[model samples]
Target chain A: MTALPASTPRKMGLVIDLDTCVGCHACVTACKGWNTENYGAPLSDTDAYGADPVGTFLNRVHSYEVTPAEGTPFTVHFPKSCLHCEDAPCVTVCPTGASYKRAEDGIVLVNEDHCIGCGLCAWACPYGARELDAVAGVMKKCTLCVDRIYNETLPEVDRLPACVRTCPAGARHFGDLADPGSAVSRLVAERGGMDLMPEQGTRPVNKYLPPRPRDALTATPAATPADPSTEGLGGFLGWIDRTLARF
Target chain B: MHPAPSIILFTTISGLGLGLLAFLGIGMIEPTGLAAFLWFTLGYGLTLVGLASSAFHLGHPERALRAFTQWRTSWLSREAVLAAVAMLVLAPHAIGLIFFNRPLTGFGIIGGLLALQTVLATSMIYGQLRTVPRWNHWTTPTLFLISAITGGALLSGLPFLSQMLLAWLAVAMVLHWILGDSRFAASGSTLGSATGLGARGAVRQLEPPHTGTNYLLREMAYVVARRHVVPLRLIALLAACVLPSVLLWIAPFSLPAIAAAILLHILGMLTARWLFFAQAEHVVGLYYGVR
Candidate 1:
């Protein structure tokens, strides 16, 4: 059961736009809020108000400073979660049959009932997407909001991943990536979306659109200094300065 | 890479116990009565204790039986299965030798092979992890297997073989460390690669995801001071290999001397195993800007 499915019926995943993310952590908070209440186990925070607080989270936002050779350095906000890879090492590395990728939707999930919490799945993941909840004693990961995505109870507009729905910048898009006609797939194609650590061979379903290039640093010329002595002051303030100088 | 005491104990002590079982299963020392009882007891006792220590590392230790079910793909599952099979198969042989004063070579050979397989599976649990480049190499399994072989030779009181293997273990460990030192850099997992921003420019962590530590950082981003590595490696090599080998070679073949050598050897192995886990660098650390 830990073996990955040969192929999924639909690769349901996310396409995150790095250029649009504002690093506000709204998606991170939304994901945490939704997952803790609905998922396999509640993400618990140990020592919440204490000096060394630790907790489990399905998603996180990291800011990186990129310094190009000829341009000004800029900060890029990166939100990270499980990519739900076609060849997910985390699922296969699990000693118990708790971790598995859904054959229908391609979403990787954990069955809390069977997990021994050995932390091997967490170690197997290169992206640090899986976290062992201290209170629940089970591995927690991003489920892509499986419950909300399919629930007819919620309005059609609300039927989306908590992160995607909450992103004010609209940086996150979710759909069936397996379909080339999907909006997510078109966005990836147009923006030249790329995979993180492609050498890892995970075949991650989530793609990241790189930030667009900023204006050239050397485009603006240096401004010349005004000749203060040659052009005498002609305003009321200048007259006051003359009087003060005479005194 | 936190070098948890439970894991260190499991790898070091369990490897030795399983190694001893491997040798005994091959009928290396066909003892009778009390001697057979003591040898069998030590072998099983060390193994059970090591396994228990490993179980303590799990968050849901009560659900450990589930680990035995996924041997089709999981190395950890295979290890549990193999260990159980080895113990069960060897039980009858052990009993026959102790009570009936007879050797069951058929069962002994089968159990011995299973014990070695269990050790291999245990090593593979770490070796199979590509996320940790240092442990992903073929050298990982080689080092673990050699350690078991050497420890088994020493525990079984094979003086010449143990001495040679001790020297061999020193050479192998030095090579393992030397090769492992460059693995992270060689892995090509820089911050830029991790973020998929390498084409743009050099990348550095400007702000972390959280102000306080989380489970990922605590579990993977463990930083062992560089200055400690040299001294610890020296201690591991000296205590585990050089001292044990020399002690065995120079000292007479007596119970007290052998016991002293074994104690020193165990001390050395503990140090070595500690370094093994502590020195490993996981690729996830690149995201945290720690590697």
Candidate 2:
């Protein structure tokens, strides 16, 4: 086995563009597929097409509609998963070392063999990322597709991740954020991205670019023209409109 | 969060063990059923041994003696100490019941005190976790009391009293779930409070400290799907409370029914316990980027 490089103090991560995301759920499906196939254990569903079906998934999309006082209708779809925090409370709380963050890539992975199926890691996460695999009796989560990204056999263009590769909207981006010149780093820098639930202080690696003005997509409504024949009626209606507006 | 099976078993078994012992002590004054006494003592002994076996899950089993040091603050310590005391009192009381054929006046009182201590200590285990808003409540103590009393009554094999206890347990479960859900909702909002800032504080996450998963996420950041929670909660209530109550009522004095009630209670308790931890919103949750 090729040994990983020496531990470095600095950690790298992803920056997601929430504004561009279309809530396709492709990322969620991609993550599930990749992890189930390659992770330490398979993510099993009791009944895929039957009643009372349950399984493990690391990524999920939450769609919300936000109406600002001055803006048109806006819909925000936030695809949330693990933030891969630096001061991960989930790590320290584990009684066993089965749950640990890599000193190299900073990837948090569960040693399936060592896991006692104590669901403490799930409790520590604020993002609701981790889920228990009832069949395997271990915890499962987003690996950022660790196995796929580093495989030398894959072509360079296809080496990113299932989520990033399959994002039809191109909302998700993955790279070494430590390099300021990287695409993710530059996008975060120029777009003035915001982190979700920043107050939690877990220091989520992912960033969300806020939705831009809808004026870019659609033309603003022009002022209505006064009908010359209805001038008298318009005057009366304008007075009523002003009065109603006050209330 | 999926707690280790050992811990789950420990809490459930011990609750049954100590709870039955406490119930027997309460009823001992009335010269009632010898059969009830026999079943209660048997259940208590078995549960105690089961609870003790769970010690193997501890990383430092030999150092379990040190667990008593923090009885002042730690419910775990209090539980250890009280459980030991309960066993001591229970053994002598059992002997008195069998050999002395004497009125268990003094031993009964001692057993009662130990039972009370066990209930309090058991409650404290969850109640003391201030991080878990759902658990850190007065209702937790009430739930503990009800669980012990209900479990004890079921194991006693006394149909009528078991039925009554089962009904009380159903009410207790409902009250606990309602109160617990409300507490969870309240703490969910306090995700903002975790940053130690007031609700208006503008603290926002800019970047996560690490790239990959860590121990904290593995231990605390677990979530069950929202869709599953409601159904599971109802199922837990049915198994833990409703079914047991119905069984107790229909077959008030049946040993099979009583045994079924005990088994159902264990299942229900386990589900409730899982939800208890799963629903609990910790201040640490704020750190994990949840609101």
Top lDDT hit: 1
Tell me, what's the RMSD of every candidate?
Answer: 2.2, 11.5
What TM-score, to 2 decimals, does candidate 1 have? Answer: 0.96
TM-score per candidate, in order? 0.96, 0.54
Can you give the lDDT of residue B18 in candidate 1? 89
Per-residue CA lDDT of candidate 2, range B89-168, in tens? 76655666655554465766687668768777777766755456677688888887887777776766666766677677
**Among these predicted structures, which one has the highest DockQ?**
1
Pick by TM-score: which candidate is best? Answer: 1
Q: What lDDT, from 0 to 1, does candidate 1 have?
A: 0.90
Rate residue A208 of model 1 by lDDT. Answer: 96
Candidate 1, residues B42-99: lDDT per residue as tens digits?
8888888989999988989999999998999999999999999999999989999999
Off by over 4 Å in 1: A223-247
